[model samples]
Target chain A: MVPTNIKNFDTLVVGGGIAGLQAALDLGDQGYKVAIVEKDASIGGKMIRLSKVFPTLDCASCITTPKMSAASHHENITLFTYCDLTSLNHEGQGIKALITQKPRYVDPIKCIGCRQCEYICPVHVSDAEQGDFSARKAISIPFSTAIPQLPILDVEHCMLCGQCEKTCPTHAIDYFQKPEEFIIQAKTAVITTGFDLLPVKNNFQYGNGHIPNVIDSMQMERILAPHGPYNRVLRPSDGMEPDSIAYVQCAGSRDKSMGVPYCSRVCCMYAIKQAMLLSGSLPLADIIIYYMDIRAFGKGYEQFYQNAKAMGIEFVKAKVARIDKGENGSAIVRYENQDGSGIATADHDLVVLSMGMIPGWDPRSICPVSKDSDQFITSIKPKISPVLTNMAGLFVAGVAAGPKDIVDTITESGSAAMEAAKFMSNSHMEN
Target chain B: MKNPDNDKEKEAKKAAMKTLRAQRKDLIASASSRMKTQKKDIKAIKEFLKGKKATIPDIAEGIDMPKDETLWYIATMKKYGQIVEAEKEGAFFNYSLNEPEKTQEKEEV
Candidate 1:
């Protein structure tokens, strides 16, 4: 009896993003005992970050809000949002997962999302909501409309200041909060730990960390958002309204010599969108896009590209060779307008590297599966099975499986959820 | 204005009007029931719509209403006529229903 916190469940979904949320909903509807463990303090993942999703420009928040509510209120779902899956060990007729929950200090049961603590906390850090667009106090809301309507104290940034502890009318602050660990016994596990944007730290040739005006595709989204810092186009370095913005497509994808080899499906379109948004947001701004191929594949995507062109967003089919610092807080982006053509340089007030999806670094690091050349979890094995790993009773979905859009991710998620459920059902029969 | 044939036409017109009235009554009844629903039920509608399509058969099965009645009410509420768009298969019937505008009218206490 190794302190068996063995709570019983049929299927365990790791990750509380849309894919995980979808899987849990499907399984729970099928009358199976299901649970979700989210590493974040709240559920909605990168989808929440998006201003609007494509193929249909429906507001992302509008779509995700209901799913978030459903997850929070599901009958069969036992959601542990601020928990991490540390280890997966085989146990009684199934697998047992060691889950570690970070302390919010505020008891979710007792803590009414009253923002007294958020305003009082003096320890400020980079606002993740702003995508490091600006800094915020440690206890602030993750976003303006974060689900659960609660605040999390960043223990790393908190400094144990006791300033917040004294101000709580609800007495919600407990600086001595301990990490709670429990074992959830499940017949099968589905991993939807989703993607991370490949970092700009490594690729210095594109100005990388060397230039402040350069941003990632997600950061561009945040900047373009009405809620974001500056709420419009302002170069990070000078705080001046940018005149020219250059987009370097496939910064992390389709470059085997530097980053992942696959052409990240979303980058080209996101670049186009950001360009269109930039031109729309600032009518006079000059926007130039450097790309290998303009991959506007989905329905109405080509029209969006054409719209961008009509709006004076210049599209040059080229591979950016380098981005270096320029005069007056601008950056110089050099590229061949077409393959191996004569090189030319364009100076811009700001530049954006359209980043690509990388596999969940830590969770994928924890699981027993081989990664691909792109670091995405392998979809098919030598045994002719999709999403099969060396380990049994484990599956992956969303960008974890490979590069996919939101719709395909949900469909694949249903399949993954079913496969995990099948393992659970079979295990139950055997037991 | 006429004799037996006119009387028969009047009777058929009355019957068609009767059907319309019955369907409209059902639609009104559906609104009343939806009004009594909690905020959670409205929330549940969003979640339920994703998985359960609220198809004519499913609605009939769920509320234990006749399929014809369910179809009639749904069609009237949707402002679409009885849809023959997708032919009914063995167990599933593919039909389109316009989502009724959720009225804010109050119900009895």
Candidate 2:
């Protein structure tokens, strides 16, 4: 039997990523009770997975970890990780959300983050957090810096040898754990749902993910990350240290065929950032970025592009026609130079596709809020107030509203928190 | 007041159970032996990549295994720190045995 718990908060933030954490912290710091419902077991979101941010090249973890820690320990913030929000509906003056907590199989109350259970587990699974380039025990924490410091048992890969249960000194490993249901009532809601990358699977033009060295931008980030699977830049197909690398921009976005017609704002800068990191790591390697048009719209972004050029990272104004596997497992890129160079083909030891981003959550069935033409949550007053959603007392922030960078996302999250707090105060005024 | 036929049936079931348990033991032993033989193949891959940098196709050709199987082996070997990336040729990376100095230098960079 699953126990049903009831909780109340002044505001509810649906996501535990940077934007969500920011919004929660903003409200919580103001002494308003806030609850964060995170789909993942940890709260850092995509930011945590990243190696560094664009423009500044600052360490991504350095900026995100503190926010994660603060939100987790905030006096007025309650974090619900690994929760599936089933339904959110209006109830009287507040909104109520039904959430089902996925079973971790390890008792959170008793289990310590000692890692003994991880050591005793015999099953080894591909670590997706590290881009599947490394192995992790079946029972292990998502990462070393993951907040909450709890390990989850992957039942599918578990052998049921009772080894983890036996080795756990606290006897926190439960073989028969069940999901729990929880209800949260909040005066207002903030949707900070993030964005997902366009999948390379069955993308025929890009070799359908069959060409191993031709990776997506996110995979390139992992490859460039200090704690990446290999701890160095290498081609996935043959583990070769690449001497020549190419970045294909707009590979996933601005293409009507893929159904994502808008530009994914961060791809260009991230590609440049990764290229710069690659240059630092592989100084002898040659880097080329094939782009339709360079969008340096953000602050100091134009200079960042110029800096990359200054570092010998070649920028090619061309559209990649198709990527094919070349000899020695290299990627053959066919393209037409915008300068009327009819057609050309080049082979690069590695190819990175800057795929577009899509809304991470679809609210059609979950809530009454409408989505824009690009399928992101629609903001009624995007120009004047980007956080004001179509639904009353419901605000949208970050990539949930549209594709934006971390800087804009953080600013928008703060805006949403302010709006939600104002809405609560107005309600009190009416009462 | 037990029937003699019932007692005979019970004895027959116990004998069948004993045979099944022996079969289970044999299966476990066979699996263990198979695993031991598989280790030699992994060792062969490690030996082939010891000083040479080769792509997946190249390594598969050297080990005389299917490309998919060879890829899995490569991934596992890499996870266990048996191999390291040497260079990228085109679409494939050339992998060599993980040498301490080479990896350490790369890390410093």
**DockQ of predictions, in order shown:** 0.01, 0.12
Give TM-scores of the second chain, every candidate: 0.33, 0.63
**What are the per-residue Cα lDDT tens digits for candidate 1 across A1-431?**
35456688888888888898999888898888888998887788888777667756677778887888887788999888778788876665677888888888676765777777866554435566666755556675577656677678765555444567677777776544678888898878887888888888768778666686888888877777766654556666534567788889889787776668887788877787778777776788888888888888877889888887888898888888888888867888888878556899989888999877777645454556667766777666623445565568878788777777788788878888778878777867887
Share of reference contacts found in each model? 0.00, 0.13
Tens digit of lDDT per residue, candidate 2, span A190-239? Answer: 99999999888847899888886888888888888887776778676655
TM-score winner among the candidates? 2
Candidate that scores best on DockQ: 2
lDDT agreement with native, every candidate: 0.71, 0.86
How does model 2 do on interface RMSD, in angstroms? Answer: 6.0
Off by more than 4 A, model 2? A1-4, B1-109
**CA lDDT of A127 in candidate 2?**
78
